[model samples]
Target: LGIGGVRLLRALGLNPQVFHMNEGHSAFLGLERVRELVAEGYAFPVALELARAGALFTTHTPVPAGHDAFPLDLVERYLGGFWEKMGTDREGFLALGLEEKPWGKVFSMSNLALRTSAQAGGVSRLHGEVSREMFHHLWPELLREEVPIGHITNGVHTWTFLHPRLRRHYAEVFGPDWLRHPEDPATWRVEGLGEEFWRIHRDLRAELVREVRSRLYEQRRRNGESPSRLRQAERVLDPEALTIGFARRFATYKRAVLLFKDPERLLRILQGPYPVQFVFAGKAHPKDEPGKAYLQELVAKIKEFGLEDRMVVLEDYDMYLARVLVHGSDVWLNTPRRPMEASGTSGMKAALNGVLNLSVLDGWWAEAYNGKNGFAIGDERVYENEEAQDVADAQALYDVLEGEVLPLFYAKGPEGYSSGWLSMVHESLRTVGPRFSAARMVREYLALYQKGQEWAGKARGEQEVLRAFHQALPAFYGLALRVEVPGDLTLNGEPLRARAYLEGEVPKVLRPFLEVQLVVCRA
Candidate 1:
């Protein structure tokens, strides 16, 4: 996959200066790049160095099991002829990924990528720290903080997750270029549109209810259930009810069953004065027995407590259902074991559509939550044991639902919408919209790519003179100029008049180098 991807790029008449490996799965690209340089008459070591200088690797998982590793014999069997092209012996090639585990030595793909990349990072700030400690052995002499691993938190594409109605509303208020400036907080100052916003959200929620009912009915028919059971599926949830959504990979550490820790308390909330319902949709790995067991336990509890109407587990969770849930749900629920979640992006998607997040203080939530936007399950405290942590988090979850989330949601006004709840929706949009957008993420990555290019140029001895010139410049260098428009210009093909004023001292020789022009943008 790695070699084919690089070759495909070359076939398109493109030669990228920077190679970004999303995870260790693509580490083989580094070897393929080195081989290209070798074929061009460069020595193996020099080729490897040049390839490494322009490569960036981003590690996504904090758990060891999540990373890919293979037996030494397996690697040799598959890559036997490949290493000959790079002018490296079998032992030398294997040493790039060699790691001594308790069972035996294995070839870790993550290790290979780390060895071959010039820059490496984790997906979030907390993940970065955890990664440094996890891989500290690779740089034993350096302090944990001094380890070279940086962080660029994951983000979701705003338009992909945003509801079309909301998108239109934003375009109407903030203009068509609103998405172009999604990272700017000023672009999301949603106010006085509370009634319309609630109406759009409720409409989406109604559509979601229809979709869920249809899916549930079909599922019962496939299982050969009774007509009465199929009919009950249609009436499973209330469209007016406050809905909480949970959807992601049902990994054990994600603690999907944490909400069921105290079934009696949960039942009370479900049967309380205000209506509430939960919509769960996710799939566990086929090999993960424990995760499957958690799913089974959740289904069993829904039947055992006879709360199927108030709670549901949607089958076949796909991107379509994900969009429905994120767009329609009132709250996004996440309960991962502390520090186990590297950086989850599901909540970010939900938040983009104004769904409040009720999550444990882990992953992206650890940095995004500001008390007003969403509710936290528990404080950022990790217990010594798993049992204790689970118990505390479950209780905290119930407390917040009963004490805060429920009351605010049900507190409606003359406009037939909860003003307080809409305030939170506004805050969630204003805060999460800008900071956790793919637009911002791509910009941050571009900066890293530029740095990688500079490093790669240095490795090839092409940037020494440029580096010295940059270093020789004064701290207070370059021009500080502002443009002023004295009069309003009509759009009747009239040329606009503007003046440029330089605010800082400049050398006489540099005067001719400065030129200013007026740039106009059509709205």
Candidate 2:
């Protein structure tokens, strides 16, 4: 994919000054660029430096084990001849990605991208810090704070995720150009439109209920269930109930079964005075047995509790189902283990449509939660073990559901709608709409691209400086260096001063290339 992507660009007469690699999956494009430069008469080292200067890498995986690696022999078998063409031996090429793993020494794609990119970033602020620590060994001379990895928090395309009815409503309230300036919070502040907003939301919820019922009925028919069972599927979820949506890849860290920790307590909440139902839709990776087990457990628990009518898991989750859930649900639920979730964007999509998020204080929510806009599962405290963390977070989820979320949702005004809930919906729209829009994300990336172009230009100019220095080597042979230090260099409360100067004539362009350093040591 990586090699073909680069060649395709060249074939189309498109020359991009900077290449932004979304993940290690595309790290091979860097090697292809180096090969192209080598074929154009540049030495391997110079080509590598040029490629590194122009490339930018963004790593989305926070866990070390999540990275892609291959056995040494497998890499040698496929890329053996490719490396030789770059004027490097097999060992030298393998050293670019060589790392020690529990299994054995392997070639890591992430390590290659990091080594071949001038700029690297993560998908969120916390992720950036996590990545710095994860790859700190690569820059042993620098502190963790000085690591070059930065973050550009992921965002969603607002219009694509926003419900069509709500989009037209906004177009009428604000001008048609409202979407053009989605990064501005003022664009979402629709004063005195509370009742209309609630009406549109209710209509969307009804639409979602119809879609869910149709899907459930079709699924039951495929399973060869009785005609009576298929008829019962049409009445699964309540349209008027407080619906909570949980949809994502059923990874274990996401804790898809967290709500089922205490079946009785969950039952009480589901059968409480206020109506509440859950709609779950996701698919586990085919190879992940644990993830598949979680999915099976969710279905089994729904049957065991005899709450099939209140809780429904939609099969074959896709973009169409995701849009329905995000647009029609009263609340969006995300319960991933803290710090393990690398900037989830589904919650952003839901929040863009005024669906209040109930999530752990991780990923973008860690930074977006302002105490009033949404509900947080727990404080930012990770326990010593996963089991303890799950217990605490699950308890917190129940507490928020019973103590805060339920009350605010059921607190209706004289006009027959929850005014407090509307306030939170407004807050979510005002905050998330501007900050988490694709416009802002793209703007941040454009800034990074500009910086990458500057780095590449500087690298090319440095090569020019090297050539000039070689041509003027005879004149530079007589150059001398002189240093001056303050006479009162002491341990007072002020910084000591020092200066260095070239004691011979130097070319105008070469003056900026000279650098000086001062080293301090403990006696």
Candidate 3:
């Protein structure tokens, strides 16, 4: 009866010490816990006091514009019954799940989460400082740096997702111990996989290339391009030749069009003496035509350079294609504008299969990179005009390829084979490749999200109900909602006329509404 939301948690077989919310996503659970205790014969004041004892929250944004707010009436509609049943007044109800203060006149999820959660955080160290200044209103008494938005830098789950063959190849490179002792990825260094593992990796890469070639032919046939022509073209592809792959979701921020900045520079890089080729495989969201258009422009360039057989665009890409391209490529190209990328995962996969990175300094690459480990493309200065940055970075990329990478590929010996590129390949595999992975990231998430083993969200069930209020899975609650928007209660806020669209559904299969305090609800 005294335990606030811990009662619900205990009911579920999880014993709780605290609660944790990912974002504004779970703020209402705080209020729900308080109300549960209040309903179970505890005074509302005592329940409210106990509610703040053990909780944590995290936010991911740094600017005020990123926060969300809703009309006050929206909160009233959902939680009105919960507060009324708990005998709490309207002012008290408005203050339960969130709060907004006088100075800034903002309703902040970061604020609610920080003030309510016993511990709170931002996703990175730099972001945590930015967030402290951004959400200083939540803790009016504390200095910005002292405000408890702890930093837990983001990570990925690289191995859980490694194609089994890729994982095996990694085990051979780093030894079985690398998986257990990932924190020090240099463990692979002492064991030293040397040159033999690279050979097996290269052969596995050939197998993946064949699979991707088959897929490309399949897609070309569907596009009304000749299936027989595409099939015949597959035979001409250079599986033994160095193949570069560029595959990621084609968001504009990624600078997917960077390679086309200089026609002459690209002409030199692509049509090399070593006959290096590219396989571009990625998809823009249906709404994102800028990236899709960039890809189409690239298609035209293959014809322009007269490297049609050498360079190809594999479309209609999915997870399966992503796996193949990562494993098959000699190098994975990621040219996102510097510092904008927030922990790219494709590069990690490439590292696993001994495919080196040709990427700008951004996201995980910024952390994992040694110039010798793979290829680094740009400087860290944030440019005001993106067009200027694109031009500069693209030129740098062109220079690196033409001067360094291509020369290495073409450099021959008495044996009539180039071996210079192999040094960089070995460096990538030994250094940045093994360390930047998802297992390390997942361990970081578990530590930061769990809050020193304080949260029991994995346990607890349902919070207390005053009179055993029941609902169904398809939640057959008998209620009527009819509103004439502009004629009904006006939304009297800034710009004064936010649009109201009325929607109706008969017998919907879920609970109808959610009420949280002081701001908007997008859920």
For each candidate, how many residue pairs have backbone atoms clashing (under 3 Å)?
Answer: 0, 0, 9
Off by over 4 Å in 1: 462-523
- For candidate 1, the lDDT comes to 0.87
Query: Candidates sorted by lDDT, descending order?
Result: 2, 1, 3
lDDT of 1 by residue, 294-403 (tens): 89988998889998898889889999999999999999999999889999999999998889999999988999999999999999998989999999999999999999
lDDT of each: 0.87, 0.88, 0.64
Alpha-carbon deviation at 198 in model 1, angstroms: 0.9
Clashing pairs in 1: none
Q: Candidate 2 on 181-285: residue-level lDDT in tens?
A: 898887886564588888998888899999999999999999999999899999988888899999999999999999998888898888888889999999999
Predicted structure with the largest lDDT when compared to the true one: 2
Candidate 3 achieves a global lDDT of 0.64
Kindly list the per-residue Cα lDDT of model 3 for residues 422-442, writing each as its tens digit: 666667656654455555555
Instruction: Give lDDT: candidate 3, residue 214.
Output: 82
TM-score of each: 0.85, 0.89, 0.70
Which scores greater on lDDT, model 1 or model 2? 2
Q: How close is candidate 2 to the true structure, as a TM-score?
A: 0.89
